[model samples]
Structure formats: C-alpha cells, structure tokens
Target: MPSLPATLLAFLSILSLVFGGKVLVFPLDGSHWVNMKVLIEELHTRGHNVTVLRASNSWYIKKESPFYTSITVYNSGGIEKELFEEFSRNILVIRRQKRSFWTKLKLVSEVGAVFEEMHRNQLNLMGNIFENKDLMDSLQTAKYDLLLTDPAVGGGFFLAYRLGLPLVLNVRWTMHGEAHFEIAPSPLSYIPVPGLELTDKMTFVQRVQNILVYMFSKFQKARTVSKHYRSFCEKYFGSEINYKAILQDADIWLMRNDFTFEFPRPTMPNIVYMGGFQCKPSKPLPDDLEEFVKSSGDHGLIVMSLGTLFTHLPEDITEEIAAAFAGLPQKIIWRHTGPRPVNIGDNTLLVDWLPQNDLLGHAKTKVFITHGGTNGIQEAIYHGVPILGLPLVFDQPDNLSRMKVRGTAKLLDIAELNRTMFLEALKEVLYNPSYKENIQRLSKVHHDQPMKPLDRAMFWIEFVMRNKGASHLRTQSFRMSWIEYHSIDVILTLLMILVLFCVLIYSIVKCICLKVVLKKKVKTQ
Candidate 1:
C-alpha cells in the first residue's frame, strides 16, 4: 500500500513497452531530415523505438540524438556537401547568364546531370549495404515493425524489401518524378507536371508543352535514374521484382503538401497529406532580436531566407537585394552565410540562421522574402506572411509560381535582379493588401483541418504498424503493364472484334448479291 504509486509507474512502463512498435527509418539527408526528424520525435513521444540509418558523411543526420538511435553505415557514397555546393554554384552561374531558350535548356541539363549523379551514388551505397552480411543480419534480427523512408532515393526501398518489412513512404518525390505520378493517376490535362511551372488550368498550347515535358521526364527516368535502380533490383531483388513496383508497393505516402499549398489533383487512399506538419505557433524571439524588431515602430519587419541549400546568393545579387532592403522603412532579417554585402543598411540584420517559423508567426512580420522552398512556403502560409519571392534552383521557381497564381506572392527572376526591381517587388507585396488577405485566408483553411497534420500522420503510421501493412489501400496499378494499366491491349482487342464483325457482315452481303446476280443470269439463259 505504501508503494502503490511506484507499482503503477512500473505497470505503465511495461504497458508502453508491450504496445509501442519498433520503427526503422532510412531517411534522405539534408532538408528532408528536418521533416523526418519531426515524425521521429512524435513516434518517440508515443513510446516507439526508432533506429535511423545514416551515411557516415551525411551533412545533417546526427549519429547521436535523444529521440532515436542512429546506425551509421560506413563508406556509403551518397550526395555529399561538396556536390550540393558545387551544383548550387553552377546553378547560380547559369541563372546569371542572359535568359534564352538555350540558357533554360542548359539549366535543365545541369539539374538532370546533378540528380543523375546523386541517384548513382545512392545506388552504390545501397549495393554496399546489401553486401554487408553483418549489417543485413543485424537488421533482420532486429525485427522492425515497419520501414519509414523518403523515396527520393532507392536505398530504403531495397532495404525494406530485403528485410521483409512493411514500407511507409515519407515522400514528395521519387527517383523518377513526383510521388503521386508514380502511384496515383495523374492526368496531364489537369494535373500539371512538376518543373513545368504550369498550373492545373492549362491552355491548349500549355497542355502540349506539358505533354512534351512529361515525356522528357519519363525518358530521363528510364534512360538514367531508373536504369541504375532497375539493374540493382535485378542483381539483388531478382528479375521478377520490378523497381517501379517496389516504389509503388509502399504502404502509405505521407505527402509533405496539403491542398493549401498544392493544386487539386487525383490522390490515393494511402496518400496522406501532412503539409505544414512541422509548423507551430512561434515562440518568443530572443530579447535582442525582439528589441530590434520593435525598433521598426509602426513599420513591421520583413524576414528573408533562401532555405538551407542556397543560403547565400551571388555577390552582385546580394548587393542588389541588400540595397533594396536598405531603402525600406521596415527592418529586415536576412539569413546569409557568405561575405557581408557592401550595401548593408543599419535596418538589416544578417544572421547565419534564424527561427524561420517563429519569425513568420510574429504578428509584426509583414512580408516573407524567400527562395520558395516547400517548407518555407508552408510556413509562410501557416503564419499568413505575404511573399516577395526570388526562386533560385530546383523546385523553387515552380513552388513560387503556384503562390503567384494564388496572388499571395510575386516572383522575380534571379538573373535580372537589381536594386530597383527588388525594391519594386518588395513594395508591391508590402503595399498590396490583397497579398496579405489571400495568404491569411489560406492560413485559416489550413488551421481548420479536422485533425492536425502531424497527429494524422502519426495515426496512419501506427495504423500501418498495427495492420502489418496498408496493402489494402495501395493500388495494384503498378503491377500492371503499361498496356494493361491504360487498357490499350483491351482496346485493341475490342477494335479487332469490331473489325471482324464488320468484315463478316460485308462478306455475307457480297455473297448474297453474287447469288442473286447468278440467279438472274440463269433465268436469262
């Protein structure tokens, strides 16, 4: 009786041990880890044991963390810090050139080459993992409840299959293209392909352009990215298991986008939209930063960050942006890692990093100047901050395009950026009340969801764990051949039957006419 409380605590611990599942995560590195870490923490809070697989040279994923135990895989060659930095430098250079069809093509080619190399690197790492008998044995013996991964790379897919674990994808992109296109039905007519920067409402010409771009994407996937993965699959998983099928076999896709940020498109039962899941109410800023922000008086502060990968723009570009900021009455907080710009003003604060979500949620924060990464866009939407966008690389332009179409943002070309243009764009966003009202409206809709995005995601993850897999919700379309999936073979059969019927009818009519002509001849003789 004296130790009743202690006894209850022990029982609760036992209960949690019995009920909590063991999740093995093979996550993508860099900004993707930010999203995955959120889920890992949530799972840990719910008493689940998490083990993360990380490359030894990973930029972001830490070997030590309070929430999850990390298993460091040595000699794994994936996208390294140097590769991204080099690629970013190339992109900046290419974008600074005169805009033309050839220039745009060069930019596209540069991106394709970089991604292809990344995929190849990931495949090599996956092969190493497969060859490691000790690692394989350890993974097999651990008896993981499920495999949670980002499908941007193919390693997790192969590992999950090898370990016979139920797979759940924390995905927005696969190796080939958008995750939805990989599993769900994406009509080119209505669902604009990524990188096209076209909206769902497309004119006839735009649709044609969409189809051409879609074909090019498919060709690139088949020729470069998918070929490597397919070869790896055949070598390891056997000839019978298609790499595409392995990608589509995921139990669930925890999409990092919601309708608020994405255009309306066909989705799947297993596709869970968890956009802005990582966002929350802003905490109080540091006293110094708060004081600086307050110094603006009635003029609110503007927060600017170009996301993680491209923290600092070219020197000339930064100078132009800094000069533009200097002219503004509102104070500026910019996250820049490079050398200080010469035109820096007293009102501007340059920091290596800032609490982006916290600043966006600040009531006095009026405008968000960004490179339009998905995470930044979602945060701005959650906090209802209008955007003055300078999209740099990858999907940044496309992301900003979506916001521009929604009238919540204005896009500026990085190549043509100058002090005057930058200033004008900032003024438009600041003075144009419509931008603020629209973003606020979207924010309201985002907040009015039935369940919080993160909670919903956690529920689905646990749901898959309890059910072993959500195969019931997964579509079998991936198993079908292209001909079968599109009903082309069936259509051809139907066409053949119709042709035979018509030919039979024609023959019968011809024989009847010939017989009638012979009878008339016989009667004449």
Candidate 2:
C-alpha cells in the first residue's frame, strides 16, 4: 500500500470532514453551555464543526435585524415574559418568606391567570427560538445538518423544524421535566413525574393553582409549536404535521439518565442515553487550582456551590451557609458567584468560579454540598464524592430525592440551614466510606454503556437526515388523540357496562323464578 502524499492526505481529510456534518446548538438554558460545553468540544475533535448561537430570552426579537444570526438567551434578561416570570418567581420567594397559605394561594392563582393571558397574546418564550430568522437563513447558506438543543428554552427546535433538519432534544437536568417532550401541543402536564417541579406538602388550592399555571404556559406554547410544526413541515419537507408527529420524527433524543443511577427505559436506536455528559473530565485544572488541591492534601476539602442561578441569594441564607462551613473541621471552598458568604474564616476560600469537575476529581476533595443540579450529581458520582443536596427549586429536590434513595447522596432542607446541621452533614459525608462506595458503584453503572452518548447521538442524526425523515420508523402511537393518550376513563366505562349487564341478567332470572313459583302455588290450590 502506498502512503498518500501530505497534500493529498490534507485534501482527503477535508473531504471526509464535510459529510461528517455540523451541529447548530442553541443554548437557551443558562446551563446549556455548562452541560454541553464538553460534549460539543468532543464532537469538534471528532471532525465535526460546532457553532453555538447565543440564545436571547424573549418571545420575539424586536429588532428587524440583529448582530448574530442565532440568539442564545439566558441571564441575558431579554425574556419577553420577564415581568410575568418575575412575578411568578416573586410569589415563590415571598410565600417562602411570609409563610402564609392563603396569601400564597391567591398569589399563585393570580400568576396562573397571567400565564394564560400571556399565552393568549401568542408569546411563548423570549429566546433565540422565538426570533431565529438568521439561523433559518443559515439552513439555506451553511451546510449545517443537525440542530442540537436541550430544547426547553431556545429556538433551535423551531428552526430545525423550519429547516427540515433533524432535531435532537438533550435531557439536560429537568428544568420543567419531560413535559417539554410533548412538542408543546398536548400540554405541559405531559412531562413525567421525574421532570416536574412539585412543592412539599402542597394544599389542594396550591395544586389547583400549580396545574392551572402550567396549563396556561403549556397551552400558550402549544399554539406557537403547532403553528410552526405545520408551517415548517410544508416549507422544509413538503409535509404537514401535528405535535406528536414532530416529536416522533425527531432524529435523535439524548437523555442525561444512565443505568448507573436509575432504572432503564427500553432502549431505542434513535435515542442515545448520555446522562453524565456534564461530569466527564474534559480538561486539567489550571496550575492555580491544582496548587489549591495539592495544598489541601489529607486535610480533605468540602466544596459548596448553589449552582449558577442563585447568585441573588438573600444575605441571610448566605450567612447561614457561612456559619455551617465555619463550624466544620474540614476546609471549605464555596463557589460563591454573587456576594461572598458573610465572615469567611481561614479554612474557607470564596471564589467567583472554580473548575468544578477538576476539583471533584481531586484526591483531597471528600464531601460536596451542592444545590443538587443533575450536572453536579454526575460530577460527584464521577469522582466518588458523597453529597449533601440543598435543593432550591425546579428539579433540584427531585434529583436529591432520587439520589438520597440511591444512597449516593443525602438531603438537607434549604429552609432549615444552620451551623449544626451543616457541620454534621459535612463531617458525616467526609468520614463515611459507604457514601464513597455507593458513588463509585454508581459511577461504574453510569459508565457501563456500550458507547459514549455523542457517537450514538451523531449516528442517529446522520441516519435521519440521510433517510430524509424516519417516518417509517415511527410508531402509530404518535397519532393518538388526547382522549386515547389518557384512556383510563374509557377503560372504566367498559368495566361499568360489563358489571351492569351481569346485574341485569341476575334480576331477570330472579323474576322468572318468582313467576314459576306463583304458577305452581296456583295449580296446587
């Protein structure tokens, strides 16, 4: 065999790279970057081009033309629903602060109504998806083949639908649960329990308000999703569609769930399970960070981070966390993004940001006090570090709830933060061999998959794009109406009819017997 010349080799490499495809990933969720930061880099190394479109948080781009073709929205504060969302978030914060059931119910109801009205106005979310025209144009100009998205917050899904490219939804930690799975037509309630954000000891009124609010939002998005689903079908593929059809036709679905931590879903060729995408050790910690870890040595460090969104934490909560950390014998490194926790002692370090995954991988790192984000859980498990989950909102509680049951992590109430509880939890996690054993055990399971998630994700994407829509592979179940999707009532009706028929037959037999007895008595007389 002749070795190719260097020029020929370079030319062939470039040719092979073209068909390898490019992914247009829109990170609408603030953590989209945090979650996919590693995955995209990996894809890039494997002869794929990855371009990130910054997402904007708004229903529509008010400006006719913008600087970038794609918008990445989150923490940009451009959300069209900003006023209403703030109101809703405020309701939770104030309710937690005031501790009034009636007041909370009233506020929740009002917020739910606002959600409905917002839907009526045809506003979905204020993000890149809502105003992704430039991305749509790129579909015509650029050879981008796939739209990779977490899909909860961005315009990538909509643009993918519009461009006739395959759409992939990454099950990044449950921002709102799997309800985002329904493609927005049916309802947000379509999301499974694992994906929902539920309150503890909720009242009936609270539940009513919660359902109403979610319905209002779901219905609002349904109109837009349905409208786009139909329009994109004809424009891109010369087809028409409904929500279920769009959902079923998705080329690839990536979930953060893994066999390591949870029960398995029946595997699908179209689905790639990549639950710990966030936790993969991608890079070496900087010299500064490595030195910090080396300095800890055997003393063992306890790491704490509230995750990205809670930078606006009240001073009181920060103070409580500080008190707890100060009381601990172990060194504490808190990823305090906003105001530093009050009164830091010598054993604690307050940094705006740290290499979270690298720190977890350190031998000196023992215990993790985390906000219980799925990303953090994957990292903790990856490094065999036990965790104390102090969940604040959304899926944090659920993640902790499941992890605690799995025995890899323990839970501490966010409302009940203090020195004793904090110190005790940290000490227990640091000293306990069982937590480490459990995490390592789970780590094996999480890694036991046949292939890494990206390979599977890429394959399915290319497969669908080549197939020009895998309509043949889809199940007819996708066409089912809402009535059929929830068929318990229909089953109950059939059962009731069967029972009534049996009762009627028994009554008829009793009447005939009574008549026969009467005739016999008359004849005897």
Per-prediction CA RMSD (Å): 2.6, 7.2
Worst 10 residues of 2 by lDDT: 60-69
lDDT tens digits, residue span 1-525, model 2: 555797788777787577566777655434545556565656665566666655244343321222223434343433244564465356446534543567545654654454344322222332333355664565558866677766443345555666667677675432223532443232223222342344334466656656776675466445544454455445544665443465456666676766565543344545566766656554677886666666766777887786766544567767767887777666777887657666566678888877788788877788888877778887887777888887665567677776786778877765566667767876777778888888888877767778765566556656755665565555454476767867877988999999999999989999999999999999999
- Compared to the true structure, candidate 1 yields what TM-score? 0.95
TM-scores vs. true structure, each candidate: 0.95, 0.71
Please report the candidate that would top TM-score against the real structure: 1
Give, for candidate 1, the lowest lDDT window spanning 10 residues: 74-83
lDDT of 2 at 341: 61
Residue 161, model 1, lDDT:
88
